[model samples]
Target: DHFVVLFPILSRNRFSHILKGLAMSGRQITVMLSYPSDEVGNHLMDLDAMYKANLNPHTDVLSRQEFRKLFGYTFKHPFTGLDYIDLYMDLAVDNNIEVVLANDPLAALSYSKDVLVATIHDRKHLKNLLLNNGGNTIIGLDELATKQGKSGGYNPEFGLLGSNLAGNNRLKLFPRDAEQFCYAVQKKLFEKTGKTVEVLVYGDGAFKDPVGKIWELADPVVAPGFTAGLMGTPNEIKMKYIADNELVGLSQEEAQRQLKQKISQKGTNLLGQNASLGTTPRQLTDLLGTLCDLMSGSGDKGTPIIHIQGYFDNYASE
Candidate 1:
């Protein structure tokens, strides 16, 4: 079996040394972006519709323009925050990139360009990129198993449940449970009171426990029971709840004052909770550091590095 380790991080103190060693090992690096498969499929269909409709004049030939327009516009989709995974795939094929690095889920979404257009020659970059993180998640089977044993019964207030996966990490929250219902009620209360509704879901050995911490920062609570059903709530209700609770004590005369304050405070809103992770950021940071160490020692067959000038200059100064 090929032993592969993954490291996900912004940058480390020894990043230069690691990069140099990686390059020496003949590993080719590419940046990766990932997206939900369904989202990508929808985008592709939209591209087809736009191309067939000849929606834009900037395109070359009517047919070719259609493809180009679709290709060009693909980057603008906020779902992935990128226009061209295909371009990256093309570049990877031409340059022979081995490993594709991605810093976050957003970056992963950007690299999805290769899912469709990459050719046989594009295989190396795709292989190395996919291999790096074991396809975006490392399932801790041991954790999932432990969680199942610990969850003797569902915690109604926390929406706790066991997952189908093999590890203790698989415990999940039920989207429609009382915890979610109560949180939704709390959000509405915030709208009425104009104070932040702190919904805390505190239960031991359960993932939903983190919802309380999020509630601590929220204006109103809107915790749902299950992960899959989270999108069902209307965005307006969510905002009203958070605004009412988080904004706290805003009379009509002070409405504008509250709005300005919220704007400055980065009042959490419709978009913010979408990427919520139950684990604290520090936990993730440590995991990434470990993964990086594991990946650094992994082998690379033979690929040349074209060092960027700034990177070369930094090393020269060192």
Candidate 2:
């Protein structure tokens, strides 16, 4: 049987597991991957070398041999020194595998009609594209664990979308009823202090590292659920612009006090104001979620809940 799997991620364990399963089924698999980098920015080749080679990943469909000849085995990630493409290729032996590098979703149809859509956010769209374009047995990562299992945890809504490896043969699924829990917390806080608080279930940050070029959004979304107070992009003004331009005649200390008053009184009205010129609008949840993610990093801090104070406070506030 011929099966085409659109593989993403650089995890050796996951690669081995998928190959083992496919081999057990006696399926000769063709694993298609995007070039330069995978979907979540796990880069496969040196970006500088790719640019130097004048290879357009948008149009170029590269075989394993072609990629190796051009980039060679010398390209490694700056921080991790991972030769991901070579690693994946080495692991595919004896599994009856042929790896292809292409950007288009329809490219997998050349190898086999039976396709496995393994992307996270692009799974639905990719499945539809494959099915409409001569695909026979199309499945996604989300559908792999939809049903309730007697042994392991399962998310009925998300399925295997937001799962992570806790141990061997064990996964940590996304928290169930996250929206309900957030609402409950908000309600409890309001009743206790008579103040409205926004609560949300956050996973990954919406950010990228300049040095490593690693996009931090491994999860599907930054935040799944948030209170109404956390809805929409933040309307903020540039305090520096106001302090410099608006308070032109004032001295250092006087300008500080005036700036504080101006920011506090500026409120939600910022149309046609020069002070709000360069300020970009970002979603409130994304902003707060990024802050929380940065504060409580993906390390051994063990800090779960983050209490943000003075967020709503102006420069004038004590």
Candidate 3:
């Protein structure tokens, strides 16, 4: 069995219990730490620390693989958290795993039909308008949809009046601002679960307005796949269509070469420091689903199976 641990930088006693539980389950396991080239030794030391800190530590359980190099540093993040690069390197070294998988949102963005909708609401009226229209169209309140009541229902005044009437009529006036609503829900859930939750937003254009601030509260942001006069690039509006709205295509060597050229030429890393964060649950689930599908035939022997337990100071962190 191979246990691949993903972290930015290995921290105190994170996987001590997991190793012990694997041993107790009587599986021959090779541990792989997924991290960066620079931090391999740092994480190995952390693994050593984890063993030392264990209450009933076993010496034979701790081991290290020949450190392998990374392609290059695309993500310039802090030297903490999970090391995904290490995971890939160690897997190739120890068990000779053929496939290296990644489903991180940013990585997946070019491969999935995911729409990032940043919403801004002015006063309560915007919410009412959003709710009535199923929260899709973009419009300004100052702009008239119809002219006075002179043309009856077709008039812009009638459109505004009808909108007002709908607002007063609906029994439950839920806020139409999805960003605010999602943030509120996530905040409450994180408080209840006591789990660290981070969101990374990517966009361009007038994203700096209200919705962009909301995105800032999220973990990080990658701005405009395209830009114009201000930034060299065009924006998602231009490339996303040609790219089929999926980032997987970009990961390919040919596609990456083209995209990188465009980014270097025109795009400015809009979000800046705000872009360093991990994957979201939806993204993780997507990755896991792909893994399950790929490895579904692991009946017993060909695929290594092991049961492991993990312990943390407070909530059981996975």
Query: TM-score for model 2?
Result: 0.82
User: By the lDDT metric, which is better: model 1 or model 2?
Assistant: 2
Which model is ahead, 2 or 3, in terms of lDDT? Answer: 2
**Candidate that would win on TM-score:** 2
Deviation of model 2 at 295, angstroms: 1.9
Predicted candidate 3 versus true structure: per-residue lDDT over 1-318, tens digit per residue:
332221222322222322233345443333323321112233232334334444122212222332222222332223444444444334343333322222121221222222111112221353344435444332332232344355333322212211211222221111123344445655775899985443211221112224212111110112211112112321212344324543454567767565555444533443322221221222322232233323432235443322212311111111
lDDT of 1: 0.31
Query: Runs in model 2 with CA error above 4 Å?
Result: 12-25, 52-54, 89-94, 187-196, 251-274, 316-318
Worst 10 residues of 1 by lDDT: 212-221
RMSD of 1: 21.3
lDDT of 2 by residue, 1-318 (tens): 888878566654334454444555666877888878878777778778888989888878889899888878887767667776656556554657777888888888888899988777788889999899889999976676667768766676766666666665456666667888899999999999999887987877888988777777766677878888788875667887876778888888989888777777775867567878887777888888888898887679774888887776656777
Clashes of each: 40, 0, 37
Give one digit per residue, the lDDT tens place, for model 1 in 1-318. 111212211111112222223234443444332211111121222545545655442322222233455444544433334433343334333343333322232233233422211111123454455546445432211112233345443433222121112232232332325456646766786799985443322211112213212111110122222222223322222335445666667676576565544434542343455222232323222232223323332137222211112311211132
Report RMSD (Å) for each prediction in the order shown: 21.3, 3.3, 27.6
Off by over 4 Å in 3: 1-9, 32-182, 185-318
RMSD of 2: 3.3
